[model samples]
Target: MKNLDYGVIGNCRTAALVSKEGSIDWLCLPDFDSPSVFTRLLDEEKGGSFAFLVSGEYVVTQTYLGNTNILSTRFEAPEGAFTVLDYMPRYRTSEKSHYLPPEVHRYLRVLYGKPKMRILYDPKMNYAGEEAVHTVFPNYIRTSSAVDAEDKIYLYSSVNFDVILSGEEFTLTDHQFFLLSYNQKLVAIDENRVLLDYERTKVYWLNWINRSREYRQYGDMVNRSMLVLKLMSYQHSGAMLAAVTTSLPESIGETRNWDYRFCWLRDASMSIDTLLHMKHQGTAERFIGFIKRILKSREDTFQIMYGIRGERELTEEILSHLAGYENSYPVRIGNAAYNQLQNDSLGYLMDVIYKYYLYFPGTLDEVEEIWEVVRNMVRMVLKSWRSPDQSIWEFRTRELNFVFSKVMSWVALDRASLIAELLHKDNYAELWRKEANGIKEEIHEKGWNEELQCFTQAYENTDHDSSLLLMQFYDFIDARDERYVKTVKAIKENLFHNGLMYRYKAEDDFGKPTSSFTICTFWLIEALFVIGETDQAREIFESMITYSNHVGLYSEDLDFETKRQLGNFPQAYSHLAFINTATLLSEEKKLSRFIRP
Candidate 1:
């Protein structure tokens, strides 16, 4: 299958509706927490997909409606032109600040000239791994099956139009455009009723978007990225997932596929920090509430990642039946990385809490309790900082003394010191400070390769890591320090590729080379800003933004040759890197005259 250029639509719960010219290639269900009834993006053959397309050659352009996540795509066909509006209703209440969900609705409208367009409505059940018995009606089609005999899923579409089901393929063609809706637990489909629901969704998104405090420059891009960040968030629990689909593959046709549909703790923390920095305190507050809730109910031990609803047991399994993306073998669902201990995640979690307290300045009993849990984590880091478990890369090879992990462990303690002083809980301030200093000294002395005049990834290793870029951003070291400047140059000289940066040499832990990570490039921009390379930073920032999908979304990695997005679609970390770096650039622009050229 050709790479379909598609946009995404979603209600706070679940999402669907992609176009064949490859726009959202239709999705609605109970929630983001629900299973897919139309998942063609993951497994095209067996995965069901809905699409709308014109016959002739066409030029496509898409953008969200202002600061909202409502996507509108315009297709200019040779004969005529048409526009498709897609949005998942934003669930909101006047009394509450959060969005919740039960049903998600997608509306498609034909604006301006109406071309003779064909609409295909195909729903594959069981992730293209199993077949379902289909029944048709005048207004809608119903498909039912107990694939694997686990749980039953039902699909109900609107009866305002006709449905044609041929074998596994379903088609819906009309002279004019029409709206089709589906959900597992939907009772009835009323065309007028659903349209009203769609309007409410649109209004809700618009209103929430308007609440954002606009930036001086890049306001539109930042807002759209923020909206995407919100869309990735699971509203019910406030856990932001890394991406919507999984098994997109890191290397095409390689067995490096993974499921990225779960909430990474580090990702959620970065999301919270970005939201707070943007003055979206309400969103940050909701996420903090989610974190506290999860920590309270579960045992002291927390996984690096969890399901959107805080699901603890995510058993990784391969969907062998479905053909992988670009034929990447053994498409896998669920993440095996959940079991690995990434010490950096703990520091990230605490760092956000510490940042919240610094900015908001309130009595956080939850923070206090979480700090106790965090103190134990600091102890874990203290015990294991020198030893390597899994580098932030989550490499499968043997672990090394990842300097970044130790740096983050230092962040955990340093921030814990601030929390201790702020909250007046005087148990471990001295000890934490001492440990933090020790780690900092070790990072500066042992972690730095004086011969190379830059910090190494680990002690006594010449290999460079993009993570060292964070040393200045995190305030681990002064931005103006010679070593930090030298390290920045080293990374720019070595990891830089086509004006972007890679995470490392991309070799396996055993040092086998891999592709460049998109997030790392953005990290370099942030580093540039901190080191007073404003023009260079802005240039790289603009260049990286161009690499996003046509709709301003980014995946985990980018193929340097093909310029194709690899790994999971719309990666949370990449967007987060965008948010953080953009914010820094915005702040720097405001104070440019005062700073040195």
Candidate 2:
């Protein structure tokens, strides 16, 4: 079965997806939201790529360098062998600032005898909307988009521009490198600068990993997931992207695709919460800064998502010129779900904020500013908690009083009460606590399906949703409660297919989901473990690890039958869930460190 056999390398400013055979198939220049400079992942024929061609007699292998984001791919043959190291430069320039440029560095080192290879350097600037003109100078090759004159990139290589541009075969006798940058270099690019940047970036990642708290088991996998999460974080604005790519379908050849390059408040807040537990307080604080910057006024409303730089209106656009991954059509950019009223979002944000007040208290001014945000979120929850709206799934066709949304609404009020009590506002705490109890009573009365013997998907229906498994996760219910146990079991029985878990079985706008929503399976695993089914949970967890792509990374979804990844590549939601569930299964029962409600 085909999988997302790709390794991601980034400097937190931008990222690239290099295929297993040493090809850069997908990349967005300058920033995560920018138009693609390379799009081979979407359209194989028209979308351009950069790859090295070797004879069929050679064997190729790919892996990351140690615990860093650097990827190394080796090609071996009887005649010769070589390794290509790929990375993006990221390091601290000062105590308070970082130096991260939008660039991709490929360092080729000859290992044995002279290796003969050909270079295929093709760049489709501006999403390949129009043809590009490639100009080869003595020192570098410049590529510019025909339609958008302002879009351009430069490639400086040591292997002679004419030889590379012409795709001529050559034998490598010495070390070489290629630097692709969004900005033209004012200083000359040379072997010394390339080696220096590579070493510095390597050291920077090593230092980052050293600072994170280590686990006894599955520590390597946790570190890898953390690095992927860090790469998705935008260094400038502190917004965490859901994924690096757009329009990768959940199921191949279907239109269950949407752009995930923007920051969803629910996803970002959950990611920050996970990082905070990993002892990465800097990322959490920066995200808090991002929140404070966006919510400038008390009257400012909350959207489910926003642009990296706080752009509010992300109008959806279809790129008809390109074919999606595996013929999935109508490649899209910008997400309409941002405007959807997802009540679950406030709970995630408030949960993180409450943790901040508890673990990382700041000056009075900072605390007061965050308190204002908490008050605003409480107002929003009070105004909207009674209405039916989109839940965590972001359903497009209809709205319902989803059980998960109601539980999260209760969470928002509960956290608000805790925060108020911590700040010495006893009256506010008492009011919100009463409100939270009222919502809980309503959920138990109407949201539970006595006939089905479990909490249903919504107040009106008896469908099972895997998201309901998070009730204990958000502290909405006790794990040992009979009702909670039955809900978890019922959802697992209905949604578990083959070895993976489906988000739900009910049909929606597109159709009933066919692929496993990866995070849902992790949720089930965590739920089972919490309910004293450790053996079943461990069995499922071990099997699920085998389903990840070649580089031990997961996407948003996976095909049940084929077990191939089938969604946005390297999704943060999937990674965070894996980290959390793996931590629970790997470590002792002292869940207080990562699971504080």
Candidate 3:
């Protein structure tokens, strides 16, 4: 039903994965964290799908509509060619403003071809728990579940066709028109309104892309990555999802599936820093404000992740009823990592605030209200720097004093002290600065192993992890440092294989990892450049970008032997790493110089 050979289209509020066969196999209505309206990605039979399938053999090619999120897929046959235009509506405020309403929850698909096609519109409501109750009309159909009568899904067509319903199936043939609206009134098909929506979406994306400070040397690969980040960004609250879908297996047909629909503080912080580096400001400010509101409400602690609307206590559970994606078991919904004590969130938060100050410089007043929150976070880091944490990997088996966690504990204090001095709120500046140095000294002493000559995954052992390479990113240490150089070489010898990288090779709760993490590979690329291995770094960079899907999209991990994408689709962490590495490695601009103290 659904395969890896697919592309994504969304309006930020919700997204869908469309197969190259012109079928929508995965989508959730209303919001990113909502229950799937079309669950075929997880279950091929019991789950639902909307497909525009051609009967005969054809060659397929897919791409976005120039710079916009509108995806255009073309199929060529011996007799004729077919095209599908798919997009989610995002109406802008005006020709001048870059604003859109939060409730533009509609999926629009238009079919254009001379070939005879088959339409299988199988929609299961409530993630297959409730079958859709459909009432056919003259030219439209209304589908909703028995559980929710008021809310509905309306499918209105633009062409002349009659729906044939047989039991649980609805089949429509010889039609090239489409309109799929959710949580809105179904009205008559307005050609002018559709044209206007498409134009506004195109204009909005083009306007946003025009502001990118990216090097044009990389061309579409870079811009498409930028567009992917924007597409993954939730327009209502500006909480960017780590990926569009969840429960995609990491090792394939295994139980490593986890939900990634929510936002991680680390992922969002890194994304905002990259956005600022690209000279884009709105999304960055909005996401920071999202985190600020969370911290402001709670004040005592920060969680690793949260729902897009800031819902807490994400209790994860498996859907035993529905089959998993491609028969992979345990399709999980909520994320249990929300309960984890990933202290790096505070460090990355402070890092973004400092980066914001570096670029805008005049936004000190905006951050003034949150200064107390920063103070509380720094005190928290100071108190728990020595404590073991679940850390970024969210290890389920054991909690250790991860070196990455400690380094970021240092990063939190480092950025807070700088922010305090920059804003002339020098009350605790010296105190934070002194503590940051203490943490750094301790890391050099304890985190490094004498025999391995590389930074260990934790302070207790010599197991190497690529996340330690993030030391270069945090400015915890520079590449020219002898210890840092040796650490890179150690990782190369231990963890790296065939130009790909793994987070660690040690035993885990789920046995040992068998795939290369895509984000870790990007980290290695940046680390290589920092060590002045420019030629090897460039080669790795060029080779790694090819691991993306047909449309230049990446998942969370890659199969080391097969080179196939794994984990969730269109991962924000992977794309964010790509953007950050691209900007840092760009020859035209030396912006990495600005990140250091």
- Among these predictions, the greatest lDDT belongs to 2
Ranking by lDDT: 2, 3, 1
Worst ten-residue run, lDDT, model 3? 101-110
TM-score of 2: 0.98
Quantify all predictions' global Cα lDDT against the true fold: 0.69, 0.91, 0.78
Overall local distance difference test of candidate 2: 0.91
Q: TM-score for each prediction? A: 0.89, 0.98, 0.93
Candidate 3 Cα misplacement greater than 4 A, ranges: 1-3, 94-113, 164-175, 361-365, 588-597
lDDT of 2 at 8: 96
Clashing pairs in 3: none
Clashes of each: 20, 0, 0
Writing each residue's lDDT as its tens digit, candidate 1 over 399-458 gives 778888888888888887777777776777777888899988888878888789999887
Error of 2 at 102 (Å): 0.5
Which regions of candidate 2 are displaced past 4 Å? 590-597
What is candidate 1's CA lDDT for residue 223? 77
lDDT of 2 by residue, 575-596 (tens): 9999999888988464234343
| Candidates ranked, most accurate by TM-score first | 2, 3, 1
Off by over 4 Å in 1: 1-4, 17-23, 26-35, 57-60, 75-81, 97-104, 112-114, 137-140, 146-188, 297-299, 359-368, 509-511, 589-597
